[model samples]
Target: MNILAIDTANNFLSLALHKDQSTHIICEDIGNKQSEFILPKINQLLTENDTKLQDLTSISYNAGPGGFTGLRIGLSVAMSLAYSLKIPLYPVNMFAMYHNALNTETNSIIALDAKLGQIYLAGFDNNGDYLIEPQLINPEQLSSVLSKHNLINDDDTIITGNGWTAYTEIFNQDISSQNIQYIESNYPSAATMINLVLSGKSQPCAAHEAELLYLRNKVALNLEEQKQSKQ
Candidate 1:
């Protein structure tokens, strides 16, 4: 199956085409400009791989717990394409993609910067099951959120996401220095979304039936708010 995957859930635009048992990817940072670059980038990836939109059997996209505008742009594009193509649209979240990229072989807790003094946290099992569905928590409550959700029941759990970088002191209080594992958040892959779809880690639906996954109530970011999620 020729599958298309898109991830504009952050400052980056990542698109991948899974075809012929091979994967082709294009990822770049075009901060706050996803709407401007995503279509062309999708075309670029498909063109480079000798493929077309109609050739895709299904589409997968980063359905959020991420940047507000980015999620909307990604969903709008994926929805439009999938609707027009009459193909299935698979819904995957940024946390799942982030955890899957690591291939850590252990359950992982993902804590992304949610701005407004809150962290967007979620956890996934080794098999890509959600131990903690994405939620917003104050930085001070990071430890409690984990405990309350039974998220990090063991010390070996892999902790990821940009929240670790943004709120070091807060995370250090929860995840000890010795237990700290830094898996850079920039490594998110649209290819992983394709793999998740093919593996049935997420289900597919009609484009019209799909919706954006927004953990935070608001999406638009001011310059200072944007600074809150650096890296």
Candidate 2:
């Protein structure tokens, strides 16, 4: 099966083409310009590989809890292509993409910086099975949450993601005694995204159903408050 996988949920913009069990990827840490570069890169990849959008069996993307703008661009492209080509669109979780890149078989916690002094977090076991549902958490609450799951006492636990890089001091202070190892890379891989779909880890949805995996609901001010603020 020929599959096109995209990952623009973070600072990295990655696109992969899977053909006959081999994968080709265009990955770069080009922050915030994914909206500008993604489609051109996709066209370049297909043209260079002698493939066309119509040849794609499926379209997969990093459905996110990462940067809101990046996620929107990725979903927009994926859904548009899938709908036009009449192919299924697959939504892969951003955290699971991170977990798939880990070299360790131990318990893994994937985190992404959620800003507002919080982090997006999820846990997976050695087999890549989710242990905790993804959530946004304040750094100050790190200790209690891990302890609640007994992860605080588990030395085999490893934390990996950009979340750690952005809030190192807070994580170090809170979980240093736990002896959890940290890996430096946080960017999700389009190659891994393809591997995930090939292994049946991702599910395909209708193009209209393709949406960002935001863990939180939309926040809005009340009508009276909006009027007061405007005044």
Candidate 3:
């Protein structure tokens, strides 16, 4: 099976082409230039791998809880390609991808810095089951959330993601005595996303039904309203 996976949910733009049992990936920290770089990179990957879009069995993408513009660009392109090719589109959560990549044996918190001093948070057990649904949360509130779940003092608990890199001091100070480990992975793996689909963890949907998982919907709506007011 041939599968294509895309992840433009953060500063990194990741693309992967899985053909047979082999995978080819292109990952770059391109900041805000995903709109300009993603398609060309995709084309380059396909061409280099001697595969075409029509040859793909399905397309998968990181469906949000990251940067707004990046997620939109990724989903629009994925949906359009799936619609045009008449192939299934699989939506994978960015946090799930992070969890899978970490391949950890302890309870984990997958977070992404959502800007405005907020973090996109999701928790999973040592066995990779959801401990908490994904949410946009302030740094100050994270301690309480962990305490609520009795995860605060668990030495086996670890925090992983770009969120830690962005707000290191805040987390260090807030949860200083917890003895939790932090891994500084800034972006999820595209290869991991493809593997999730192959393992049946990701279910495919119609192209038109594909959508980004923007956890901060209310904040997004408010920003839109503010923009309209200025206009």
- On TM-score, the leading prediction is 2
Residues 1-231, candidate 1, lDDT per residue (tens digit)? 999998898888988899999998898888899999999989888899989888999999889877777888999999999999999999998787888788878878888888777788888888888888788888888777667766444755778788888998877777564453556656677888987888888898998899877676554564456677674
Could you arrange the candidates by TM-score from highest to lowest? Answer: 2, 3, 1
Scored against the true structure, residue 14 in model 3 reaches a CA lDDT of 92
User: Which one is best on lDDT?
Assistant: 3
Residue-by-residue lDDT tens digits, candidate 2, 1-231:
999998888788899999877899898888889999999999999998899888999999988887788999999999999999999988899888888888578998887887655788999888888777799887877778778777876877888888888888988898887877887774657988887898888988999998888775542334455578779
Candidate 3's residue-wise lDDT over 38-144, tens digit each?
99999999999999888998999989777788899999999999999999999999888988888889999987888767898999997778897898888888888
Report the Cα lDDT for candidate 3: 0.87
Estimated TM-score for each candidate: 0.87, 0.90, 0.89
Candidate 2 backbone overlaps, count: 0
Please identify model 1 stretches exceeding 4 Å from their true place: 149-153, 175-185, 218-231
What residue pairs are clashing in model 1? none
* Alpha carbon RMSD to native, model 1: 4.3
Per-candidate Cα RMSD to the true structure, in Å, reads 4.3, 3.4, 3.3
Residue 140 of model 2, lDDT score: 79
Two-way lDDT contest, 1 vs 2, winner: 2
